[model samples]
Target: MKKTLNINIGNSIILIEEDAYEMLTGYLNEIKFHFSKNADHFEIVTDIENRIAEMFREMLLQQQKQVISIDDVQLVIAQMGSVKDFENADEAEGGIYEETISGVKKLYRDTDDAYIAGVCSGLGHYANIEAKWFRLMFLVSFFFAGSGIVVYLIMWILIPRAATRSQRMYMKGEAVNLHGFIRNFEEELAGNQLISRSRGFFVELAEAAGRIVRTLGKTFFKVVAWLIIILGSCFFLAMLVGMAVFLGFSDANPNEYFPLNIVNDAYLSSMVFAFFVALAIPIIALVLFAIRVAFNSRAINRTVSFGLLVVWLGGVMLSIFYITKVASEFKEEAEFSQVRELKKYDAYTLTLDRSRFFSRADSVKYQINSDKYRGKVILNDMDDPYNLPRNVRLNIEKSENGLVTLTQNNSSHGKTFEAALSHAQNIHYDFSQQDSLLNFSPFLQLNRNTKWRDQEVTLTLKVPVGVKLILNEEMDLFSYSFDYWSCEDHGAPKAWVMTEEGLKCTKP
Candidate 1:
């Protein structure tokens, strides 16, 4: 166990063994004495001491040692080179040193030679190309979706600025030895071409624009962050209120609605909560980030942020699981048809029926007594929010057997064929005839508490040739078999005749 001493060098405290401390002191003294005759000796010596301290700290960290050993001091001295090595250089007065070792280059921003952020210059140094070529490439690439601007800003932020002489030397691929250090110091004092270069008109203009943008960009970003904070908080609050309203009003039976009706009632609440968590967490995170930018502080601790992330991921996974589960229900499809014969008539009128048909369960739920409300019909508005999509379609065709008939085709989807058939059978549609008038319902209805499975009804009216028919204007909504609007010029109560080709508009 050799004795250790704490010493202060270049404003940094370091622990070193007795022999290592003596060797480091001697080396520093030798450097100081050699540079004492120079006009800028104090500055050069200070920079060397700071570089030495930085290297020592790096050695301690990389080697995991408590105190600097004699071997560590010798290694540092060899890398920095001895004063005798500098004196023996070929051009010591001109500050031109012999290349003793090939140095590895690092990418660092050369602010002294930069127009904006020195990104191009740093890249040029690393790639051993002229900076003008990189600048021209970036300028040309800016026209392609402004990608060059994004790439340059990213590199500026990611690449460190060379603030020290040693770092600048490393960036320029110069050896970090005594000779290189003195050469760099002399060049800085005498002013190099890189610092004395004149800027072109366009380059000067660009630099001026960059400075203005940077000055205004800080204020613009603050305003944007504030706007995000306000908008995000409002959205987050609205989400909470919406989730509460949906979960609170259980009697409203929201699952009976069109889109929500697709999900199973068993996990409806769980799915809704998961969706809320998944959606709300993002808004919350955005608000927090905005707050950090606007106020320069974190709103939550690292633990809370981590917890929010976990919860958000859980919510996303749960939502995906439920979505897959619901999608599986639509794997199979089934359809069935029914045919009915109508009384013989030379001419008939087809119209949409707005009257709603109520089942016993619906009557009970609305507390309407059948006998008390006899003969009174409840008109269904076509624009009701609770109503499903218009699932009914009508087609008129020439009859093959010269008989008047109507065919109803109903279809639905489910996890299995039998289940799909059951769902299709659960659909209820209304059609009635009074003398020459035929009425068709606008939408199909499902049995009570039944989930939606893409149920649909298609009606086909087959009439004998030469038979004439008058159709209501609203009937066009259910007919896709022909260009109904084209028949509008025939006059109100559009008339059609069954021809060999099919139904044709009759003359006004």
Candidate 2:
């Protein structure tokens, strides 16, 4: 077994056998000694060392070799060639290099002049074109397809970065030997024919515009991120506070909001919890992302992020399921109707009596402002009488029999016919008699246990022919808006007698 030593080559760490390490060191020393006679000896030697380090790193990574052997070092040296190969070259050549091009060019990411990744730069070098051309091509494609960024990211992930002098030379289709390496380094130092050259006015202007755009784009993204964070956090916190308040206190009269009344305690709790979780996860994620953008914080762990995403998805599914479940309750509908006969009387009068209507035995002090009708309506459980919409449709017709008859059709809806009928039956309406005067309630009342299902009443009055009917001013309270003309001109009050056709105006 040979002893191995850990060494850092360029910016890469590698393991090399003791004999291999000594050979590599000796080879570098020889190159240094040869280049020592030149004015740019340091530059040439440093470039060579970086090249050797890069080669070692590649061998270790690509070949899966745990330790570099002496044979590996010898192979690298042979490929690079020795100082004797170029020792006889004329110094009077004015350091002018011949075109030592190579057809075998390797693709690499150029980190030196890269804006985001060096993929474009590497592509430019491989295609023997200017990097600006690749940049322009990518920029144009970015607007058309927005696919340039995705392709760039994929290329960045797949292509190896050009990390050393020798690899960079190979990427540019230049020879990797000592003479080429020294020539390239000298050109780079002297600013002759390096990767980037001085540009004309348009090129400089384009570069400046690119810089400004990049800066503005970065600022805009940061502002958007911050806004998302603030808005998400505020909404999330507000929802939490609402939930907290709900948990602390129960709704005073859930029947006031009939849709909520149908939702049982068990399902209501589950649906609310699922809704909160489903809504909160994305909001929290946005907040976290915003925090990261604002503070330049480290990203969350991938495992945790994936787990949160899965959990959020489950919450969303649960929320959708409960929402569908709740919505299904209104799918079916039914109504209940009944009619009652009125006792015979000589002369009948109709008037709305608000006092006797709200005089209930078990009335509570709960009032709710409801939007169940065209305008705002008040619903009071105790004293106030305008509880529900007064959708009372009425028609007066001549009765075949002499006795007057009143017909009432109360209608409502529910998930099932039976449920709907039960709710409709729960509605309480009063139209009783005091001698010949009939007292009617303007609005219908639904008890607390009965969920609202658009409950309404239709009252039909059948009056015998020759019967005198007295309709007071309170007839205006009837939802149909009865427009009978009897004002200061006829202060004595006009009486209508039920004729064969309908109610006819007659002098009282």
Best by lDDT: 1
Instruction: Please give the lDDT score for candidate 1.
Output: 0.84
For residues 451-493, write the lDDT of model 1, one tens digit per residue: 9898899999999999999998778778478878778654488
lDDT of 2 by residue, 115-136 (tens): 7656788999999899999999
Q: How close to the true structure is residue 39 of candidate 1, measured as C-alpha lDDT?
A: 86
- List the global CA lDDT of all models: 0.84, 0.72
Considering every candidate listed, which one attains the maximal TM-score? 1
Off by over 4 Å in 1: 1-111, 114-119, 135-205, 216-223, 292-301, 380-385
Q: How do the predictions measure up, each by TM-score?
A: 0.66, 0.45
RMSD of each: 13.6, 16.6
Query: For model 2, what is the error of residue 493's alpha carbon versus the real structure, in angstroms, after optimal superposition?
Result: 20
Which regions in candidate 2 have their CA more than 4 angstroms from the true location?
1-197, 251-259, 296-299, 338-356, 359-362, 366-409, 428-444, 452-508
